[model samples]
Target chain A: MDAIRTEALTKHFTVGFWRPRPYLALEALTLQIGHGEVFGFLGPNGAGKTTTLKLLMQLIYPTSGHAEILGRPVGDVEVKRRIGYLPENPYFYDYLTAEELLEYFSALFGHSAAERRRRASALLDEVGIGAERRLQLRKFSKGMLQRVGIAQALINDPEVVFFDEPMSGLDPLGRRHIRELILRLRDRGCTVFFSSHVLSDAEALCSRVAILANGRLVSQGALSEILAVTIRGWELVVSGLTETALAHAQSSAGIRGATRLGPERYALELPMTVPPEHLLAKLVAAGATLVSLNPLHDTLEDFFVRQVAAAPEERGLESTRG
Target chain B: MRAIGHIAVNVFRESVRDKVLYSIVAFAVMLIAVSYLLAQLTAGQDLKIIKDLGLASIATFGLLMAIFIGIGLVWKEVERRSIYGLLTKPIRRWEFILGKYVGLVLTLLVNVAVMTAAFYAVLAYQGWGVDELARRAWPAPPMDPALLSAIALILVELMLVTGIALFFSTFSGPFLSAVLTLGLWVIGHFNTDLRNFENVVESRAAAWLARGLYYALPNFDTFDIKAQVVQGQHVAASYIALSVLYGMVYPALVLTGAVAIFSRRDFK
Candidate 1:
């Protein structure tokens, strides 16, 4: 059974104090996420990423359709036993210490006192909370609170975890820390579903991805499949090239173009059809030296921009993209 | 069951840590002490005045704690977005509402208990305050156990107020919730007028509306025994028993509404 599945799930929020109207926060969104995969739900801000997570969490009711986790319907109490969730910019009860917060959540899963203590202590350490720091969460930094949020979510040792904008509002180091933790969860064979507007973070962690724009599913598949992981071309940087050799290199059928890098230095952009060895041999014979040769593949960021660009009517909303 | 307990315990701990609870309780204690000075100004009626004011202080302050803190019981979780993590847990939505209500009631219990003890202490001190005054006021000894009956009803009233606060907060922000809860509390004391309201009103629709509200609104005045307690008049045990039953049952019904509203809500 799929770890998570949604069928035509939709939500419409009645906004405005007066003359309230139903605003389509999320349209019919259908998704199927298999077990034990790190799936990234990629979207720009206001693209219904958080709205989707809230629906799956059953924090809000769906206006139409339904969802299920581990073959159980959403809002099933038993299904939550196997699932965990960390919200965007998670806010815990600041009156509680990190351990206290974890322990409290542990108790919700019916853990024994000793088990609760053990789980709280272990998860706190796993999330990088020190043993000596028993300060209330209100006193902790944002990064520290976020760490506690992760610990609380994992207190039940869930098999599937949902992270709503996990790396949001974190510094580079903090983001890296969460990225590594997510990778570790994936390594443990836990299905990790996370929403992220930051494509780069998703790029390094996701095996499969689903791009969402304007509350609709734009595309979904393995990252390599969607991005069409083919070598676009080679970036060839060379120096010590004679002017004749440089012009000859630019004239080559495989060479896309050449630009002078500096004195006696020129870089050539080549199509994938260009043979690295043949180019090197010809360039060597012409008294040119190779500095660097690297293949460039399609990037998720460019693909994301292209997808967003394709939807012009909705393009205006992309101005607030994160 | 366990989830409710956990949420309730957490709410109690959060409320205890609230400086507002402490400030209000401390202010009540200070006010109870001030009652002694005010009582002295009345000469012969000093002891009676002290008892009356102390019970009044307890009821008023307890109501404040119930309204201010109770309005935030569920609203705070929503505003802080903490409910995002909580609702995803292996617990029912009704459990969350029940837990918050139980937790806030527990906090009110502790607050009322402390304020009651302080009030009793003030009465004790006045009883032994002076030689001539002590004998004069000692017809049956100053600290009557009947005062506890009044405090008991007051606590029940406070619970009802907290439940009303929770009920409104399910569908409204803290501001509107407070206003509505307080409005109900004030009108609850006067809703007995609605019993006779149908008799005075000319319009049949207005009478029916008044009767509906009379039945629907909380009857806070039913719990009042302070006047009888202070005057040393006998109050039937049956009256307190029925009032307590009504108080417990009313909030439970209101909380049922709260849970239904909360369950249907979209926390967007």
Candidate 2:
């Protein structure tokens, strides 16, 4: 069974004060997510990424259509017991310490006191919140609170987890830690679905992805299928090159983008049509040393930008969809 | 039920750690302490004056606690976006609404209990008469357990206030909720006036409007047995039981309404 499925799920919000009009927040967002896959829900701000997660989590009712998780309806209590959700910009009662917050959440799931204690301690430690676990959440940094948010979501050890912008508001190291955590969750055979505009993180972590633009699913498929993962080009960093040779490489038609690194070094990007060996031989004959060569491919960000840019500017907004 | 308990306990913990609650309790305690000193100036009415002031302090502070804290019970969760995490849990929407109500009620209970304990401590001092300073004739025993019956009614009244506050909080913002709750509290205490409002007014429609409101609004005067209990007059056991039952019944209905409204709400 699919870990999550939505059949023409849509949402419309009534807006305006005097003359109310319907605002389309999410279109007919029919999608399927299989078990044990890290499905990336990618969209720009206000693109209905959070709205979709809210729909799946049953925080808001869909205007029309239905959603199911773990082969059950969206609001099934038993299904909820097997799933975890981290909301966008997670907020918690700042009065309680991290341990107390987790314990309280565990209690909601009916965990025993001893089990709550063990889980809270272990999760807090695992999230790198050591001594700070004793301090109130109000004292925690945004990144620290994000960590706490993840720990609480995992406290139930859910089979399917949904996270909304999990990598937002984190430093580089913090982002890396969360990335590793997502990979670890995937390794455990847990179906992980997360919404993010951070395409690089999605690129690194997602096996499959769905891109949303203006409340519409613009594109979705396997990473390798949707993106050209094959080497599109190669970058050769050359050093000790003569000025005349550097100018020749810069003016070469085959070299797409060339940049001068330093006094005697230059980096040249060549398309797949241009063999790196030919460039190397030419550069070596011109008394240049090849520092290193690396292959480049199409990134998720490249696809995402194109998709969002090409998508119509919110089509059929005047009419309603069911 | 278990989810409700967890949410309630967390709310109680949140209330316990709040500095505002401490400030309110401290001010109420100080007012009760001042009541004792004020009673010394009255001749032959010290006991009456003290009991009146003490009960008044408890009721006013308890109402303040109920209105202020209760108004935020749901509003805070939604405003801070904490409800998003909670509604996704393995609990029903009615459970969330019921849990919030129970938690705020529990917090108000603790506050009322603390204030009641302080009031009793002052009464204990009056009874013990620190260092043989006693020898004053009293209208009633200073340490009256009957005071609890009055205090219990006050708690019931606050419970009603909490339920009404929560009811508004579910559908409205805190400012509007507070206004509506305080307005209802004021009208509730003067509920008798609404019943007899026809006598003061000339218009028949206004009188019927008043009569309609009389039945529609809570009769909070039912819980006010402070004067009878203070003056050592007999308070009927049946009356107290009926008032408590009414108090419990009203909030249950209000909470049901609250759950209905909250269940259909979108947490945007």
Candidate 3:
């Protein structure tokens, strides 16, 4: 069953002292997230990713169109019961400890006293906040607070969870832990819909991604499908670069672009037609030692910049010509 | 109903924990104590003075509690964004409003009970004799029909204030709601006077306007049995019953308006 489905869901926010023109934050967005699937919303800043999540969570009303969750209309309490949401830049009560905050939320859900205690403890442990259980949230570090935020989102054992930039403002370890947790949520058969400006995190965590730009969905599919049109190329790193060899390579047709990695070293992007053996021979003849050669894959960062920079209506999943 | 109960219980717990309740109760005790001292300054009408001060403080402090705390009930939920969680629950908006009002009433009831107990305690220690006073001239303490009537009226007055505060909070922020509630309280207190002034107004249009104001605001003075209580007057149970009915109807009207306004709010 589809966990979430939207048909032309649109939301417009009006702002100004007198002349309030509708700023379309979400424009006719239509998509479906399957049960137990990890779907990532990928976009740059101001791409309406967070707005879409807010609409799904019923935190904001759409100006037009509709959405449904678990076969029920969006904003239905039954539908909400099955979903948990973590807002971007969430501001919790500063006076409450992490446990107190969770308990308060649990009460809203009408969780039994026993269930609340058990779940809060388990979630705290899962999010690595069990050690800081006694600490007030106001004194917690940003990373620690984010962990508590995630823990609160998981309190209800929701079948579907929406995370808005959950991995933001985290160190490498914290990022890895969140990525692992997302995987675990998927393993435990929970559908995860998340939004992130960080394409790399989306790439690593999402099974499929939707790319949005200027309040419209530009492209969406499996990572492989999204990047299918990107050009295939090879990377060559030459370590023992003598001036003569560097000069020869700088003037060669086989090396389309060369960037210096360090002193006496250069990383070059080679055309597919040039075999590694021939490149090595050419480098050796030019008085350079070939250190490494490997195939290069386009990262999601490359996809984001190219997609967002294109016209919203003109952009497709296909890669731009190099 | 269960959801309403749940919301009410949590609201009650949170309000009791708030220092506002204790502060109001303490201030009431201090006021009642001051009344005892102030009664000494009045040469011959010590009992009357004490009764006026004690009952008035109860009524005033009860109004403060209702308006101040009741205004924050819904606003706090909105400001904290906790209303999202509640709205997303299987509870109706009316239940939330009713639950909050009920919770605040419970808080006010406890505070009033504590204050009344303290007043009784101080009166007992002061040891005033009621035997010497004329039955109709000066009311007996504890079992005075008028005093009992005043106590009942104070409860009704507090409920009316809570209704007003909740009504304002349905659309306005906490600060504005409190201000409006306080204004309404003042108008309600002088409602009978407004009506009397309307009856004697020279201009027919001015009389109609004042009459409109009199009906529009709560008739708070109708619930002021303090004078009757202090003067040892016999207040019939039927009059008290009728006043209770009036109190019930007015708050119901106010709460109905509150629920309607709150249900339309988007909470975005």
Candidate 4:
């Protein structure tokens, strides 16, 4: 069974005022997240990423439809007991020491006194807060605070962990540590759902991704399948072409697109089907020498822009498929 | 229940660390000392005046702690975004509110205890006329019987105020909640006078409206037996029992409403 599933899940928030209209934040978002997979959700700002997380966590009520976690309805206490959430820009009680904060959360999760101390100690160490567990949160830097936030989320040994923009505001080293932690969580057979706007991280870490735009699920599936349909091609450059040769080369159209790259050099885009030699020989026959040939592949970002910009019906097909 | 206890413990610790508690304690002590000096000015009312002032300070300071700190408790959680972490746990919203209320009450209990001890120390020191020479220098202590009754009344009063503060916190911001709670306190203090005025009204409809308002507001004066205790009148245990019951029931009603509103609120 999927660790997470949503069918026709929708949420509308009413702006409380004299004259009001409900704003739809998530429109019929449906997807299934399998256990032990790192599912990446990529979207620009206000694409309903945070709203989806909020609804899943039951911080706010959904207008219609339903979402389930671990076979239980969303917001069920049993489901909540197995899930951990790290909110974007998490804030903590400034007066609490790292150890104290973890202990507090552990108790809330029904950990015994002995288990609370043991787990808190281990988590503090795992998050690299071993040496400064006694220091108050106010004294810690932003990166340290983030580490503590992660520790607090993991205190329950949750089966599912949701991280909303976990890498925001972190230094390069901090970002790498978070990525490693995410990998470690996934390795432990925990279902990890994290949201990010940066496509590189999603491409590198996620086996599958869901892209959202304007509060709608645009595309979602295995990263490979999403890219397979979007074409991949290479770039070719040629130089020393006369006006008649340029006209001939342009008219022949062996390459997909030919545009001037330099004073006498022009760049040609060729589909992967068209071999580099055929394009080079064509340029040579047309009285132009091949200057540069480089292959370019489609990235997750390129696919994101294309998928998010596509028509609604076509976009929904990618997300709704099993 | 365990989660509530955990949150309560943390809130108690945080509140104790605030400088305001110590300042209130020090101020109460100073008030008790000043009462002794002021009592010296009145030849025969030393003990009576000291007891009145001491008990009054305890009640006032305790109320201040409850209203000011309770307003900030939930507001602080929202402002710092800690509510997100708490909500994600396996705890209910009512538990959070209950825990915060318990923690603030605990803080008030400690602060009031300190002031009570200081007041007792002052009374003990002044009760025994020092030496003949000291007694000659200082005026004789006054005989007061209502001090105990006043202290009991103050406890009941603080309970009611804590409830008011928590109820206001459910739907209002810190500043507005504080103001509303203070307004309730002021109205409650003169609740008996309002009832008496309501009784004297000539028009039946106007009297009914006045009576309705009086009953809707907390009848705080019913808890006070200070005059009877001070006058050396025999105050019945039933009076204290009834006052404590009144204090308990009103706050429970108010807290129920607070929890109802809080449970439905969307913490976006």
Candidate 5:
């Protein structure tokens, strides 16, 4: 069975007093995530990523449709026992120390005193917060709080974990630590579902990714398939070329554009259909010393930009591209 | 049951650390102590004045603590977005509501107990140092055991107010909840007056409205035996039992309503 599935789930919110208007936060979001896979939900701000996570967690009720986690319907208490969630920008009780807060959360899951103590100490250390276990949450920084938030989420040792903007408000080192922790969760055979706008992080961690734009799924599939852009061409660099040779190269067939690197040096881009041997021969024949040649590959950031820039009408249709 | 206990204990711990709780408790103790000085100003009724003022101080301060703290008990969690971690847990919504209520009640109980102890200590000191005039005017001891019954009834009244505060807090912000709870408290004390106003009014609509409010509002006067206990009037054991039962029933109904509203809420 899938770890998470949504069937046309929708949510609408009403705003304003003079003339109440309905705003669609999430619309007909149908998705399926398999067990034991690290799935990434990618979207820009206000793209309904947090709203979708909130719906699955039952933090807010949906206006229409349904979702199931671990083969049980959303809002099921039993299902919640097997799932851990860390919300974006989580704020805990400031008066509570890290140890006390974790113990309190573990107690809600019916952990005994000895178990709570053991689990709280272990999880705090796992999140790199062992030194601050006895420090009150109010004294901790944002990164420290985020680490403690992760500890609290894992206190129950849930089978499936959902994180919304897990790496938000963290330094580079903190971000790397969280990324490693997420990878560890996946390695332990836990199905991890997380939402993030950081395309690079998502590219590194997610086996499968789904892109959301304006409350709709624009694309979803394996990272390799979705980011697969066929190589359009190659570039060749040469130096010690005369002005006449440079002009000739610029006007050559299959040469898309030529850029001057410095005095008597030029970089040439050629179509894929063009033979590199022909271009190199032409440069050598013109007495231009060969410099370097390389091929360019499309990155996940390029695909994300293209997906986000697509029109709303084209989004749902573009999901079939991968 | 375990989840409820967990939440309740956490709430109690949070409440104990709040500066508001400490400030109110200290002020209440100071007022109880100041009542001893005020008693000397009254010639023959010094003991009676001290007993009345001391008990009144405990009830008044206890009511303020209950309303202020109870209204924010649930609202603070939502305001700070801490409810996200809690609601996503294995516990149900009703359990969270009940747990917060129980926690605040426990805190109020402790504050009232301390204030009651301080009041009794003052009365004990006064009893030992009574002048010739006070000794002749009042043969009865100043440290009356009956006062404990009055304090107990006041605690019951504070519990009902806490329920009212919690009930409003489930749906409204803290400020509005405090206002509505305080408004209800004022209206509840005048429930008898509302019934009398219904009979005296001529307009059918006005009379019906007053009568409806009288039946709808909680009758807090039943729990108030401060005057009787201070004046050394006999209070039957049956009266105490019935009043305590009445106090317990109102909060139970209010809590049920609160849970019903809270369960339907969307944390968004």
Candidate 6:
């Protein structure tokens, strides 16, 4: 069975007292995440990524359709036992120390006291919060609180984990640490589903990714497949050249542009159709030494930007299959 | 059951950590002490005055704690966004509500116990008098153990009030919940007056409305045995039984309503 599945799940929020107009927060969000895979739900702010996570957690009800986790309905208590969730910008009881909070969460899953203690200690250390376990949560910094939040989420040793904006508001080191932890969960065969606007993290970690724009899924597929924008061409750098030689390379056939690096250096952009052998021969004959040749590959950020920038009508027309 | 217990313990710990709980308890203790000074001015009726004042202070302060803390119980979790971690667990919504209610009730129990102990101590000190000659001139009355019955009844009343506050909190924000719960408490105490007003009014609609309100609102007066206890009158066991039943039944009904509303909330 899929780790998570949603069929046309929708949510509409009402606003204003006098008029009470309905605002569509999520619209027929259909998705499926396979077991033992790291799935990234990518979206910009207000793109319904958090809303979808909330609906699956049963913190809010969907206006239409349904979601299932571990082959059970989203709100099933038994299903929740196998799932752990860390909400975006998580806030816990400030009065509880890290140890107390984790133990309390473990107890919710009916873990024995000894088991709770063992798990809380291990998870606290795992999340890099072992040293701060005795301090109250109120004294924690934003990053520390986030680490503790992850510890609590894992205290139950859940089979599936969901995180909303897991890397949000973290320093580079903290972000790297969380990325490693997520990778560890995946390696342990725990399905990791997280929503993020940070495309780089998604690219670095996710096996499969889905992008949501304005409450609708615009694109989704394996990272390799989705990031496969055909290489437009290659970039060639040549140095130790005279102005006449630079002008020759710039005017060469199939040369897109020549950017000056210095008085003696120029970068030549050539389309894929151009033969590299021909370019090398021209540069060497002109007494221009080759600095380097590098292939230009499109990044996930590039695809994300293209998908996000497309009009709603265009995205709807080209929605990618799972 | 274990989930409820865990949540209840957490709630109790949270409440205990709140400085407001200590502040209110300390203030009530101070008032009980002040009652002793006020009693001296009354001369012949000093014991009666002290007893009445002490019991009244306990009830008043206990009511404030119940309303203030209880109304914020669930609302605080939502405002702080801590409910996300909780509701997403294997626990049910009704268990969350019950756990919070039970925790606050336990906190109030401790508060009432401390105040009651202080009141009894003051009574004991007063009854003993200062010196041998003072004791001969105006001998202090024996400390009555029956005062505990009054304190017990007050606890029952406070539990009901806490339930009302929790019921309001499930759907409303703290300020509005406090207002509605306090309003209900006031109206509940005057339910008898509402019934009398119904009989006196000639307008049928007004009469029926008053009558409906009387039945709809909790009759908090039923929990008061303070007057009798203060005057050294014996309260019947039958009346205690009925009042206890009423207290238990009303809060249970209110809790059921709260859970029903809370279960439907989106926690948005």
- Name the top DockQ candidate: 1
Task: Give the per-residue lDDT digits (tens) of candidate 4, residues A1-322.
Answer: 8999989888777664786656667889999999999999988876789888888888877788889999998778788789999888888888888998898888888888899999999998887786788988889888788888888889999999998888877888878888888899988998999898988889878989999887788789998788876657778878887667767766665667878777778887877887777657766887788777877668888888887777253222212110
For each prediction in turn, the share of the native Cα contacts (below 8 Å between chains A and B) that it retains comes to 0.89, 0.89, 0.21, 0.81, 0.89, 0.89
Per-residue error at B147 for model 6, in Å?
1.6
> Tens digits of per-residue lDDT for model 3 on B45-73?
77677778888889889988888888988
Cα misplacement distance, residue B227 of candidate 1 (Å): 0.8
lDDT of 3: 0.79
Better of 3 and 4 by lDDT: 4
Report, for all candidates in order, the number of backbone clashes.
0, 0, 1, 4, 0, 0
**Residues B1-268 of candidate 5: C-alpha lDDT, one tens digit per residue:** 7778888888889988889789999999999999889988988787898898899999999999999989998888988999999899999998999999888888888889899889989898888866777576773458889999999999999999999999999889999999999999998998989889866878989988898988889989988999988878889999999989989999999999999998888777
Return the candidate ranking by TM-score, descending. Answer: 1, 6, 5, 2, 4, 3
Off by over 4 Å in 1: A229-231, A234-246, A258-268, A272-295, A312-322, B129-140, B201-205
- Could you report the DockQ of all the candidates, in the order they appear? 0.82, 0.69, 0.34, 0.63, 0.76, 0.76
In model 2, what lDDT does residue A89 have? 85
Count of clashing pairs, candidate 3:
1
Q: Please report, as a residue range, the 10-residue window in candidate 1 chain A with the lowest summed lDDT.
A: A313-322
Clashing pairs in 5: none
lDDT for position A250 in model 4 = 61
A36-153: candidate 2 lDDT, tens digit per residue = 9999999888788988888888888999989999999998899889999988889998998999999988888889999999999988887788999999999999999999999999
Question: By TM-score, how accurate is candidate 1?
Answer: 0.92
lDDT for each candidate structure: 0.86, 0.88, 0.79, 0.81, 0.88, 0.87
Q: Kindly report which residue stretches of model 4 are placed more than 4 angstroms away from their true locations once superposed.
A: A234-269, A273-296, A309-322, B130-149
Give the lowest summed-lDDT range of ten residues in model 4 chain B: B137-146
True-structure RMSD, every candidate:
3.1, 4.4, 5.4, 5.8, 4.5, 4.2
TM-score of chain B of each: 0.95, 0.94, 0.90, 0.89, 0.95, 0.94
Minimum summed lDDT over a 10-residue window in model 6 chain B is located at B133-142
